[model samples]
Target: MDFSRTHFELFGLPTAYALDRDKLDAAYRELQNAVHPDRFAAQPESEQRVAMQWATQVNEAYQTLKHPVNRGVYLLRLQGIDTLDASNTKMSPAFLMQQMEWRESIEDARAGKSVTALDALSDELRAAHRRIEAQLAELIDAARDFAAASEAVRQLRFMDKLIAEVGDVYEELES
Candidate 1:
C-alpha cells in the first residue's frame, strides 16, 4: 500500500480510460479491509492515525477511479495536464453550436412544461453522452491522445451538468 501511488496504481490496475469495474470493486474492498480504521483500534495512537490517513486516501482513490469522467481527468493530470484549469476553456465551434441548440430546446421544454419534449431531449442527451464516452475510451486507451481526451472530458463535463438539469426538470414536472 504505497500512499504516493496514483489511483490506478493504488488499485493495482492499468492507468487507462477503459477499466474493469469488477476488478476495481475487488481491489477497493481489499484495500478498505486492510486500512480500515477499526483494524488499528488496538494499536498505538500513531498507528491509528496512520490507518485513518490510509483509509481516507483509499476512499478518495476509489471515488476518482470509479467514475469515467474523473478517471479521464486524473489520467491527464498524471501527464502534467490539468483539464479543469480556467485557462483550458477552448472548445470547438461545432460543439458550441450544439450546446446552444440543446440549451434552447431545454428552455423551450421548460417554458411549455412539456414532459414529452423533455423526455425526448433527455434521450438525445443520453445518446450523446454515450457517444462521448466511447470517444473518450478510444482517445485515452487506444490512441493515448491526452490532448484530445482533455477536450472530450470537457465536453463530458458539460453533458453531466446538462443531464443534472434535465433531472431537475423531471422532478419539477413530477411535482
Candidate 2:
C-alpha cells in the first residue's frame, strides 16, 4: 500500500496500454475492501484519518486505470510526457479535414432531425475510436513511442468530444 506506487503498480497490472478489464475490476474491489474507511470506524482518530486517505488514493488510482483515455494519459505522464500540452495540439491537415467532415455531418443530421443518420454517424465514430485505441496500444505498449502515443492520445480526446457532441445532438433531436 505504498502511496508512491504508480496506478498500474497499485493494481498489480503491467505498465502498458493494453489491459485486462476484469483483472483491474477485481484488483480494485480487493483494494477497496481492504482500505474501506468503515472498517476503521472503531479505530483511533489518526487511524481513521489514514484510512480515509488510503481510500481516496485507491479510488483515484482505480478511476485512472479503469478508463482507456485516462489510463493512456497516466501512462504518458509516468514517462514524463504531457499529452495536453498546447504545443502538441498540432495535427495533420488530413485529420483536421476529417474532423470537420464529422462536425458537418453532425450539424446536418441535427438540423434535419434525422435519427437514422445520427445513429450511423455514431457507429462510424465508434469504429474510428476502436482503431485509434488499437493504435494507442501499439504506440504505447509495443512500439514504446511515447511521442507518437501522445499525439494519438490527443486525437482520441478529440474523438471523445466529437462523440459527446453527437450525443448532445441526439438529445436535441429527441426533444
Candidate 3:
C-alpha cells in the first residue's frame, strides 16, 4: 500500500489502456476493506488519520481507473502529458467536421421535439464512441502511442458531453 504509487500500480494492474474491469473491481474491494476509515475507529488518533488518508487515496484511485476516458488521460499524464490543458486544443479537421454535424443534428432534433431522431443520433454516437474506444486500446496498449491516445481522449471527452446533452434533450422531449 504505497501512497506514492500511481493508480495502476495501486491496483496491481498493468499501465495500459485496455484493462480488466473484474480485476480492477476486486483490487478496489480488497484495498477498501484494508483501509476503510471505519476499520480504524479504535486505533490511535494518528493511525486513524493515516487510515483516512489511505481511504481517500484508494477511492480516488478507484475512480480514476474505473472510467475509460479518465484512465486514458491519466496514462498520458504519467508520460508528462496534459490532455486537458486549454492551450492543447488541437484536433483533426475531420473530427471537427464530424463534431459540427453531430451538434447540428442534436440541435435539430431538440428543436423539432423529434425523439425518434434523437434516438437515432444516440445510437450513432454510441457506435462512434465504441470505435474510438477501440482505437484508444490499440494506440495505448499495442503501439504505446501516447500522442495518438491523447487525441482520442479529447475526442472521447466531446463524445461524453454530447451523449449527456442528448440524454437531457430526451428528458425534455419526454416531459
Candidate 4:
C-alpha cells in the first residue's frame, strides 16, 4: 500500500524473476477486492479517491510483475541499474552484431515481400526471446547476478522493439 515500496514489496511477493503466476493472479484479485472503489462507496469522497488510487497501483504492479520481461527490467531498475542509460547500454559485441544481422534480414524480407522469409525471422526472434527469458531466470535466481541481468534487460528491450517493428512491416505488407 505504500507508494515508496517496490512493486514486489507492494504486492507482498518475492523479488525474483520466477514468480508463481497463479499465486500472483490470486493476490491481484485479493488486492482488487480490497481496494476497489465500489467497496468504498459508503465512505467519504477522499476515502473513495484513495481506494481508486490503491486499486490502480495494485493493477499496475500486478501487470508489471506478472510478465517475464517487465519483471526482469523492474528488478534491474530496483537494483539501481538503468538499462536505458547510454553508459549502461554495454551489450556484448557479438549480440550487437547478431541483432544487426537479424534486423537486416527482416528488412530484406519485408522489401522482397517474402512471407516465408518473414515467418522464418519471426521464428528466430521467438526462439531468441525464449532463450533470453531463461537467461533472465538464471541471472536473477541461480546466479543472483544483477549486473548480467541488467545487460539482459537492455538486450530484451531491444529485441522487443525490433520484433514490433518487424511485425509492423509484415502488417504493412499484408495491407
Candidate 5:
C-alpha cells in the first residue's frame, strides 16, 4: 500500500533479475483481491478513491515485474540507468550482420510461402532469444553489470520484434 515502494518491494520480492514467477502470481492475486475497486464500492467515496489508486499501483507493479525485459529495464532504472536512451543503441557489428541475415531469411520465407522454413527460422530466433535472456540474467544478477545487461536487453528487444514479425508472416501465409 506504500505508493513509493518499488514493484519488487510491493510484492515482497527480492530486487533481482531472477524471480519466482509463482510467488509473483500469488502475491499479485492477493493484492488485487484486497484492493479491487469493486471491493470498495460500499465504502466512502474518499476510501474508494484511495482503493482505486492502490489497485492501479498494484497492477502496474505486477505488470512491470512480470515480463523479463521490463523487469530488467526496471532494475537498471532503479540503479539510475536508462536502457531506453538513444545513445545506448550501440550494438556489436556482428550482431548487425546477424540481424540483416535474419531479415533476409524472413523475407525469403515469406516470398516462398514456406511454412516449414518460417517455422525453422522461428525456432532459431527463439533459441537465440533464450540465450540472450540467460546472458541478461547473469549480467544483472551475478555480475551486477548494468551496462552489459542493458545491451542484452536491447538485443532481446530486437529478437522480440523479429519473432513477432515472423508470427505476422505466419498469419499472412495462413490467410
Candidate 6:
C-alpha cells in the first residue's frame, strides 16, 4: 500500500533471482486493483495522475521480475552492480575461456552439420543453466552474496547468447 516501497517490498518477495510466478502474479493483481487509475476516477487530477504512475511502476516491476535474466540483472542493480555497463565489463579469465570454448564448439558443430553434436551442446548448456539457477537461488536468497551472484549472472549471459545461436543454427538447418 505504500507507494514509496520498492517492487520487492511491495510484492513481499524475497530479493532474489528466483521468484514464485504465482505469488508475483497475485501481488500484481492486488496492486493493480488498489492503484488502478479507474479506482480514482472521482479524485482530483493530481491523485489520478499519481495512481497512473503507481500502476505503471507496478506493471514494470512485474515485467522485470517475471523473467529470469531480467530478475538477475535487477538484483545486481539493487546491489549497485551494473553488469551491462561498458566500464563494468570485468570477468575472470577462466570464465572468458569457457565462453570461447562454447562458441567454438557451437561453430564446429554447425559447420559439420551434426545434429547430434548440436543436441549434445544444447543439453550441456541447459544443464549448466540449471546449475546456475540453483546457484543464484543460494547466493541471493541464502547467503546474500551479490558478488558471487554477479559472477553467475555474467556466465549466464554468455550461456543465453550461446543457446540463442544454437537455435539459429537449428533454424538454418531446418530451412
Residue lDDT tens for model 3, 26-136: 999999999999999999999999999999999998999988799889998998999999998989999999999999999999999999999999999999998999999
Top candidate when judged by lDDT against the true structure: 3
Per-residue alpha-carbon lDDT of model 1 for 56-138, expressed as tens digits? 99999999988878988999999898999999998989998998899898888888999999999999999999899999999
Per-residue CA lDDT of model 5 for 1-175, tens digit only, reads 6889999999999999889999999999999999999999999999999999999999999999988789888999999999999878988888889989999999999999999999999999999998998889899989999888988888988998999999999999999
List the lowest-lDDT window of 10 residues for candidate 1.
1-10
Q: Per-residue lDDT of 110-136 in model 6, one digit per residue for the tens? A: 899888889999999888887888888
- Per-candidate Cα lDDT values, in order, are 0.91, 0.92, 0.93, 0.86, 0.93, 0.85
> How high is each candidate's TM-score?
0.95, 0.97, 0.97, 0.90, 0.97, 0.80
Best model per TM-score: 2
| Model 2 residue 5 lDDT score | 91
Between 5 and 6, whose lDDT is larger? 5
4 against 6, candidate with superior lDDT? 4
The worst-scoring run of ten residues by lDDT in candidate 5 lies at 87-96
lDDT per residue for candidate 2 within 24-48, as digits (tens), equals 9999999999999999999999999
Clashes of each: 0, 0, 0, 0, 0, 0
Model 3 gets an lDDT of: 0.93
Model 4 has a clash total of: 0
lDDT of 4 at 81: 73
Model 2 residue 146 distance off true place after TM-score fit, in angstroms: 0.9
Measured on C-alpha atoms, candidate 5 has an lDDT of 0.93
Which 10 successive residues of model 6 have the least lDDT summed?
Answer: 83-92
Model 1 misplaced stretches (Cα beyond 4 Å): none
